[model samples]
Target chain A: MEVVHTIADLQSRIKAYRRRNDQAVGFVPTMGFLHEGHASLMNKARSQCGLVVLSIFVNPLQFGPGEDFERYPRDAERDLAVAEAAGVDLVFMPSVSEMYPSPTRTTVSVSDVTTRLCGASRPGHFDGVATVVSKLFHIVQPDQAFFGLKDAQQVAVIEQMVQDLNMPIEIVPCPTLREADGLAMSSRNVYLSPEERQQALVLSQSLQIAKEYIQSKSSQGFTSTELASLVRAHIETAPLAVVDYAEVLSYPTLEPFDHSHSISSLIIALAVKFGKTRLIDNLILQVRK
Target chain B: MEVVHTIADLQSRIKAYRRRNDQAVGFVPTMGFLHEGHASLMNKARSQCGLVVLSIFVNPLQFGPGEDFERYPRDAERDLAVAEAAGVDLVFMPSVSEMYPSPTRTTVSVSDVTTRLCGASRPGHFDGVATVVSKLFHIVQPDQAFFGLKDAQQVAVIEQMVQDLNMPIEIVPCPTLREADGLAMSSRNVYLSPEERQQALVLSQSLQIAKEYIQSKSSQGFTSTELASLVRAHIETAPLAVVDYAEVLSYPTLEPFDHSHSISSLIIALAVKFGKTRLIDNLILQVRK
Candidate 1:
């Protein structure tokens, strides 16, 4: 329930906690306006770790000039209640000035993997995510860090960053938490009008359709084109759903699927537009090896 | 004196050592082939940290094609001796295969500042350096990291990385160590022929002359074209020295000299080619307030 502000205070507290016998720390980093998705992440962290530390930072570095940095939803009191309900221990909420003093110039990038999908749409977005996540990882020095698979490309980028940087914390990929209607939850869900919220359900349904297709077939792999067409048709058919991109990719790598790619490693990734908000969801179907 | 090759072993050992107490860890990351310059960095780390860990890695991602990645010098035994003499506790010398498993694909960058100086010539060089250094910072988990001002641009880039990422480690910049004749020390100093060695001295001597010119009230800061000419002439006159660039700059910012720049932050930076190895040197002089 303790909300720390400064880096020094946080580090000192984490260090002290480390000394009082082996305490396993778990971290969940988020931009504010928490939802069930963030709660699931905290739950995952709380399940395994002695202390769960969650960070609510709407990092400006990740947002392009035209992006939703200014308008990004933030409500710390409600977020605190959600964290408390989720059994979180500490909340490390830093101010923009505290996070980035003047002359802020550093960035953490995950190379080629970051150059695709969300990276293509929002350039340097993942760099900001990777850098902020890395900072949280260092500050909390967590035993395990939990990230939801809802942001599949972000999960990939973080995995690459931790591996490339040799960070000690274990990155646990939590299953994407969805609403009762099969809509994958996101903080930006707040941005959606009631009508837009109803349309967003198509994204998750399309992903489910892809998953069901692969699960039904005893084939080696479906062509990337066929899968794309099916998902695109689903999105285009809906009045509220507009297909931003619907592609089959190699799991983790984000490379376009080929005939050589096995069904077990195929990722049906999609970006669909519902009004002003762009929501991404992917289904990674694992078949017999 | 201990050389740990595997990432797991080093991580385990470091974790165990860290458990003993809150010992301040200091780090010096380098490509092996240790010279006095590197030894001085180790000595600095030794004095500042309870445990000094030096990692020697010639990161491939930082080098472009036609760059000397394959031919980059390395001498583990010599590096070990120097590290040992300098009182380093652990020397992490990981091979490419060990540090980067086959599918490595992440990078860290420092923007703006990286877009200038060394970044201009080497393109993605600082990106590579930032990525590797970030990896090192994570792996070593040092309280402070040491860097040489010999690579003034690298120091700036790293400072950017450390700040931008909000990494916990302090970046300590050591003065550029030099040979008796004024040649700045570098691992590539080995590549210099006996004649090339003499020519390399011009890089430093030219800066020394510039320093004296500014001290003697060589024209007003930005208006002193004569002082700039003298600085360039010193390098041009040397038979083995080919001037890469010689310019007066504003320190820290690395901006070209302009009328508005504060005199207190004026800096003179130079780069020269002595045979095949390019050498760099700089001198910072305070401008009148």
Candidate 2:
């Protein structure tokens, strides 16, 4: 796999790629510390595309002022190895200065979809994500971009942006990967202490419990309020897990369910803190008639 | 020349063009009623590129509540004739609904540069320009995009957006085309009355006067305030012309010059209303060292 650091180098490489033939380029953008989840995205890209480009940059824009921008986990050697293993054709590892040469004056902002869930919790977080993703999309000019559903709201925001702006790229959303104990895999997982790690399982467990309940009661649907409470109650069992937000909303739109209409699909999202590390997990369920 | 109305048709046509071995597609976006300024852009695009794509979209997003969106001049047949004359390979003339299938939720906005001149007079104008241009760029995926320097602030905003967003497309700024009477070529010029059209000469005349004054006293640079007044006073000489704005600022950045530093380049921008029709013109000057 070829690893490029500069935008000029990557662009030149992209030009060369385009010159060869009509190559379907697939991109997987991530913050370094790659795990099985990132590997899945790269592997998925490799399966379909002639060229798979992976970008590893812990975007400072996505983090809030008081959030974990300073000490975000990054392991370059491991990330490159993971990329190579997943058969990534190119790896773009750009520095903070490389990504943002100057203070960014242009912002790609999406409204409505970005006003709830994580968007509400961390203000301007999605704007940062949208702007950085836009830059990456322009740089890569990929045919299809792979994103893990671990950040469900992010996927929704990106999808909305692509459609609204008429960006000619397909957004392929992959399923969220989980550990053996049902905890969602994240770079921040390393931050968890033995006790915190054990408690973190509550996030996925609660989501799973909520999913099964929704499935069982599919015929006679529970209100959004009822489902949210059920998820919250389950998470509270774990003493260390502090519920930041546990929401039951319409998938992709992130809008609260209108009780009058039949709920076809819903995403039960969770953001809970265990000690210092905050872990998030979600399950998108399609309600059966 | 092939004329396409739908985005799908354009994409298919673009794909066919791309398949013909690394064809350089140049784009010229305009609000119909093609004047010599738009023709100049198209002609320049044709000269440099393998294929030229012209889009005539009278974007409503740029117009303020009381502004002339409904009255925006458009001549599809004439525009196509002009495109063909300029050797444009394709023309994309999408309707309002076609361009915006839904109310646009995503906005590509550039700050600092957009806070003055026309951007100040017409709020959300640059955002509309940036958003639609972004959509066109995505849909067409052109190698280079052309913009006439008649709308200098617009050129500055687009250049900043392309740079900030890393839009892998070259922005070629063509010189503004003018009538024999020195009025800048604009689709809106059609709205001017015969008398109003005569008075509109004051817009370009004042800018030209300021340009000569700056060139004559390049060594003894004038303050931004002094230069603005000179242009404003010249425009005031025309009884029918209402001075909307006449100001001098640093080129591209649109920032007011500081007397602490020696001035190098300045853009004398003017917006004057001749009856109900507003006309704008600008002169970009390079200080003779």
Candidate 3:
């Protein structure tokens, strides 16, 4: 696999593939510290695409002040090895200066969708995500781009941006990968202490409990408030886990769940802090017909 | 020349050309009354690019609530004829419903530069232009895009967006085409009455006077306020021409002109109302080294 650090170099390498007319380029954009979750996304891209381009850049724009941008885990050698093992044809590892040599005056923003969940807690996060993804999409010019559903809100924001901008690339959303104990895999997982890591399982556990509750009450249906309270109660039982937000919202549109309507599919998302480490997890509950 | 009305049809036609690595695609996006200025841009694209795609979309997003959106001049037949004569390979004339089938939730916005000149008078105008231009750029995926220097502010907004987003296409700015009477050619010029048209020449005439003043006073650099007052005084001479805005500002940046710094290259822009028709013109003055 070829590794390139500059935009011009990446474009030059991709130019020949672009001109061939027969090859389908797939792209996977990440913030390095690659794990099984990222590997799953790259594997999916490799299964169907003729060329796979993976990018690893710790984007500072997405992190708010006091966020973990300074200590965000990065392993370039390991990341390159992972990409090569996952069948990535080209890996783009751009420096911060290469990605943003000057102050950025342009912003790509999606309204309504970016005002809830993690967006509310982390201001300007989705805007940063949308902008960097837009830059990467233009640079890669891929036929299909892969994103992990672990960051469902990020996926939704990108979907809205692509649809609104009429971008020609297709967004392929891969399923979220989990640890053996059911904790969702995240790059920030490195921040967890032994105790915090053990307590983090409460996030996935609460989601699982919500799934079962919905299954039991599938016929009668449940209010979003009821499901939220149930999940919040479960996480609060874990002494270390402090609930930040546990709310149920409609899928894709992400509107507040309405009790007046019959429940079909809803996203139960949560963010919790175990000690100093924050973790987020979600479950998409659909009524079994 | 092939004329396509739907995005799907246009994409299909351009797909083959996109696959062929050797061809360079050039794009010209317009609101479609096809004046000499637009023809000049298309001709420039044809001279340099292997494929020329012209899009005629009367973007409603760019028009203010009380602006002339409903009555925006459009001539599909004539536009196609002009494009064909100018050697355009593809003409994309999408309907309003086709371009925006649903409410747009995404916006591409530029800051600082958009808060001055025309942006001050027409709020959200540059945002609309940036969004639609972004869509067209993605759809066409052109090697180069052409814009007329006549709408210099629009060109600045687009340039900032392309650079910030790292769009791979090069922006080629073509010189403004003028009539024998010195009026800058515009589709909106059709709205002018013969008497109003005659009076509208003052828009360009004022710019010319400002240029001459700047040239004559080059030794003793004039303040922006001084040049603005000079141009405003000239436009007010015409009985029918009412000065809307006449200001001198820094180029590209469009910042308020600083009197402290010696003028190098500055943009003197003006807008005037002749009866109910509004016309705008500008001149870029550079110091002769």
Candidate 4:
């Protein structure tokens, strides 16, 4: 229930929590416009950890030049309420200057896993995410960190980074939360007009169609190309929907599976533009042996 | 001292040490061969910390293609003896496969500070050093990590990386230890022939010349170009010495100081080739305001 703005204050609070019996801290890092997705992560942390730490910083590093860096939503009061409700022990909301005191010269980058999907569309985006998450991980020094599979590729990238770097923390990935209508929850959903909001359903709907197709015995031995085509054709049915990318690749690695081999684990990822708002959703599935 | 090869073993040992009264861990990461410079770092760690952990990894990532990676000197028995003598509590000597079981997909890189000096001469060298050191820091989770100022630019890059990432560890830069003949201590020093070793003294000799010149009040307001020429001229006196680089720049930053600004702290760095052996040395000086 304590809120802190500076890194020093947050560290002191975390230390105090640890000093009083070695607390198992869980961290949930977000760009703070608390939707059901972020809250789900926080609630998961609260359930499993002794102390839950939530960071709400609209990271400018993750946005491209013409992207929504400036227009990224902020709702500190609402976010604080949500954090309190989720039983977060500490809330760290640092200023841009406080997080990045100077122009950052250091970068934490993961290759292969970051070359496709959202990473392909937004260059240097995952580097920014990786760098910021690295800074947050160091600052929080938590036992486990929760990440929503809403940004599935992000979870993959972060997991790869942690494994490759031998970072002493666990990455607990939570299921992506969805609306009653099946639309994936995201802060950027607020950017959609009423008509655009309705059209965005094509994203999750196409993912569902792909999921059913993959689950069907008739769809056995389907190549990535065939699966991608099925998803793309379905999304194009929406007049307002413009398919940015519809990719069917190996999960986490994001690499195209060999057609000669049977698929084991796969992810069907989509990014579609409904007006100026670009929405993304994905479904990870495991094929039966 | 207990020697561990697997990361799991090291982590378990470190955890046990931490569990008992919160011991302050000190880390010394090196490429083995056990020179006096490394001993100095270990000695410093031994005196200051409750437990000292030493890692001997001749990181392949730091060496350029066609460089001396295969020929990199290592002496596990001697290194173990040296660690025991220096009072190191744990020695982590992971095999190449153990350290990098898979191709490293993640890279920790620092810009600006890595763009000059050895970074320029050896491409991707700092990235390798940065990545491995990052891995070691995470695995050990030491209170303070010791590094030799013999590799001054490396110290700067690591310092920058630690600051940027907010790594909860201190970087202790130990002074460069040298041979009685004035050559900087390095594992690569074993490559030098007797005559080449004699000529290698020019690397440190020139640093001494620059240090003396900078200290003599007459050298006030001297430009980097003037300082470089004076040192370069002295280094050229050695018959076998082929000056690879002899430059003067601002300490740590490695950027050239502007003539309009009065110099406060500066580093004169040298890299010289004697026959096939290459040696490097540097001197950091503070001008009286």
Candidates by DockQ, descending order: 4, 2, 3, 1
* TM-score for candidate 1: 0.93
Q: What is the descending TM-score order? A: 4, 2, 3, 1
C-alpha displacement of B279 in model 1, angstroms? 1.7
lDDT of 4 by residue, A5-78 (tens): 99999999899888886768999999999998899999999999999999999898999999998888888999
Question: What value does the lDDT take at residue B91 in candidate 1?
Answer: 86
lDDT of 1 by residue, A1-289 (tens): 8888888887887877777858689989888799988998999888888888899899988898788899999899999999999999889999988887775666666777766677888887987888778777866788898888988889888888888788878899988888889988888888888988877787888887777766666565456787788888887867987777788877788787566655456678888877778888888766465
Model 2 — TM-score against the truth? 0.97
Q: Is candidate 2 or candidate 3 better by DockQ?
A: 2
The worst-scoring run of ten residues by lDDT in candidate 4 chain A lies at: A214-223
User: Highest lDDT: which candidate?
Assistant: 4
Q: Compute the lDDT of residue A79 as modeled in candidate 2.
A: 90
Tell me the lDDT of model 4 at B81.
Answer: 94
Q: What CAPRI grade goes to candidate 4?
A: high
Candidate 1 reaches a DockQ of 0.69
Residue A169 accuracy (lDDT) in model 4: 92
- When 1 and 2 are scored with DockQ, the better candidate is 2
lDDT of 2 by residue, B1-289 (tens): 9999999999899888778746689999988899888888998999899989999898998887988888887778888888899999989989899989899889999999998999899989899999999999998999999999999999999999999999989999999888898888888887888888887788888887777777777688667798899889888888998888888888878888767756667888999887788888899987654
Tens digit per residue, CA lDDT, model 3, B172-270: 998989999899999989898888888788888888888888778878767789889988988888889888789888887888757665546689988
Candidate 3: give the clashing pairs.
Answer: none
Winner by lDDT between candidate 4 and candidate 1 = 4
Model 1 CA lDDT for position A224: 72
